[model samples]
Target: MKRAEQVTFGGGGLDRAAHLRGDRGALATAWADPAAAVLLVWQGKPLSTRSGRGSSPDQLVMIRPDHPLAASHRENCIFLGLAPTGAPQFACDISSWQPDALDQAMLASFADASEQQHPDLPTGQVFTELRRMMAFLTPLEAELAATANAVLSWHKSHQFCACCGQPSQVAQAGWQRNCAACNTSHFPRTDPVVIMLITHGDQVLLGRSPGWPVGMYSLLAGFVEPGETLEAAVRREVLEEAGVKVGAVTYLSSQPWPFPMSLMFGCAGIALGRELTIDHSEIEDALWISRADMMTVFAGDHPGIRPTRKGSIAHFLLQNWLADTLD
Candidate 1:
């Protein structure tokens, strides 16, 4: 887990500049600087620079400050404030709104000189695949993209007061939505998920969810229910999925998974039993394989197993486990 932060969007020590976000004057000053860049998101998809030919894919909804909606909605977005190297960062999601300037030309328009694709331009798609195809994003890009999606999504859903039917107002520098009628405040949410790598001697257990592609198997994972500790979540999830009792669960690492806001807690557990009676309700299939078998999977030699998805914490943990560093 030494390279815990190495995953793309994992940890780059971006400046964040939390203290400055509340200062209206400073925030306006940073945005006015022409060098300041925005991470573009439309319905949770981060904008990226395009590669390859195919008429360039139409991705992202972005425009300059002169645009009409810029004033009304931009304040609802989070100002990540600054990157570690001193560049400013911002995030905005333009999903539902119609930007007058959007067109095929946008697919070729590069953002901030970084060569990363922003999103799948066309409609009727979730942001999942677009995120997967990205190789990486600059620290500024990552910060802007994360902030925009997190804040905008919160605003879109929480326009009304939870305590009363009255409307709310944006507060906390776009970080909180407060209801004047009921005096209730709401903030963005991140769900907790426990992803575990269960190992016994040289063999490991993996499971395929109901809808995954063929050969796709990953570390067993589930949400951490109320009142459950991380270790208890690991033990219970493994047992519930594969019928494998686990002991001595140890935390490995965590990743911010922003597909609708999730924090993945990665852990390793001591496997107490090998016989897997998979709960079909939680997983489609579960298997235990030796180190030699995994080597084949990693090498593309296993006909039935595929390598883990790139940039996933599951892949990161498995790579460390293979290198004998999980201890």
Candidate 2:
């Protein structure tokens, strides 16, 4: 756990200027600064410069504040923070813009492989799925994109006040919503999820959902319910999904999983027994794989299983476990 923050979307040293969130004058001044830049999000995807066929890395496309698109959406801009060089960073949602020949079906699929291009933007810069490009982005880019997507998704889903059931207005530089009717303030929410790496002897437990691709499996995970601790969540989730009792749970690392806003808490647990009576409703299959077989899976030599996605906490934990570096 010493390298806990080394996980993707956790170690980035982004200077989130929280002091300026409620300062309208300071925000306006920062917005007018020449060093100010904006990132545009369309349908939950951030605009990025596509990576080349070989060596290039995909980067977030930083648009000038004065750009036509950014300017038009200025009223709804969220102040993300300041860059390392003191430049102001902001994000705007342009989900209203429709593209030509748009395939609605692909956009709603499990994995959206399509890229969207705006007519006014430069060529090669498209709004791509974050999941598809997360592993290839720089640490800072990953952090910024995750923050923007989470905050924007929150605003879209929580437009009304929970207290008075009245429409709320953006406040605190997009970090909060205020309702005039009840004078109530609501902040962006981040749900906590516990993903466990349960082991017995030299074997680890993994499960695949019903619709997962063939040969794909990952550590069992579930949401942390109200009044439940992280340790309790891990034990309960493993037992519920795979009928495996877990004990001695310990925290490992965490990742900001912004697939609609979640913080994944990666933890290690010891399994009391190797027997797996998978709950068919919770998972399609569950099994215990030894360390040797897991190595083959990581190396693409295993015929029955594929490696977990890169940039995910599951892969990070499993890799560290394989190298005896989980401590």
Candidate 3:
């Protein structure tokens, strides 16, 4: 796990200026700085330059703070942090702006392939699904995009105070919400999920959800329940989903999955036995695949199995396991 942080959405050395979160004076100066830039998010998607056909990678589009679109949505801005060059970085949600002729069906789909273009924004820049572009973005851009999406999603869902049943207001530069009625402060939440790589001998366990694509399969995963440790979660999830007993669980790496704010904890576990009694309610199918067959799956030659999606912790763990680099 030495290279654990190399996972997608891992730490990219972004200076999240937490000390300045409550300093209104410092925030004002940073906002007014000429080098300040704002990243735009629309309905959970981040604005990005489309990837080119050649060697160029898709990039997060950071526009000037004074831009008309950003200025109009200034109240919705969240102070992300400072860039390496000391420029202030912020994220603004322009989800209120509706694109012309937008396809509502596609937008509501599980895999939203549509890219939205604002009439006022620069040409070639569109709000694209983060899952579609995550692997193509730089490490720093991936981190920033994940942070912005998670925090904004939190704001959208937690508009009311749980303590006093009153509306809450944004505070601490979008990192905190304060309720005046009860004087309670709430922070963004990241649910922890344990995705296990369960192995016995040379074979690994994988399962596919009911509606997943025919050949798509991945490591078994589940949310960590209250009062449960990561190791316990892994064992419990594998047992519940596939009826496989796991032992000697060890942490591997983690990825920030911002499809609504989740931190996926990738772990390796030894299967006590190979027998599987798949709980049909939890998964459509479960099987044990040997290393050789997994290699075939990764190479796209296996007719029955498909590789896990790139940028996911499961993909990273499996790739490393194949290369014997999961140290």
Ranking by lDDT: 2, 3, 1
Evaluation by lDDT, superior candidate among 1 and 2: 2
Which regions of candidate 2 deviate over 4 angstroms?
51-54
- lDDT digits (tens) for residues 1-327 of candidate 2: 888887777766778999999999999998899999999999999999983335787789999999999999988899999888889999999999999999999888766889999999999999998877888877888889999999999999999999989999999999999999999999999999999999999999999987777888999999999999999999999999999998899999999999899999999999999888889999999999999999999999999999998888999999999988999
Model 1, span 1-327: residue lDDT tens? 676776545665677677876788888887776666665566555654442224554333334444443444576656766667676666666566544444535433322122322243334222323344333454334435555665676777788887897899887667778898878988877789999989999999999998677889999999999999999999999999899999888888887766557789999998998999899998999999888898889888998999887667788888888888875
lDDT of each: 0.70, 0.92, 0.91
How far out, in Å, is residue 45 in model 1?
Answer: 1.1
Cand. 2 TM to true fold: 0.97
Candidate 1's displacement at residue 95, Å, is 0.7
Candidate 1: stretches off by over 4 Å: 51-72, 97-130, 138-140
Write model 3 residue lDDT over 26-62, tens digit each, in one string.
9889989999989999999999987433578778999
Candidate 2 local Cα displacement, residue 246, angstroms = 0.6
CA RMSD of all predictions: 6.1, 1.2, 1.3
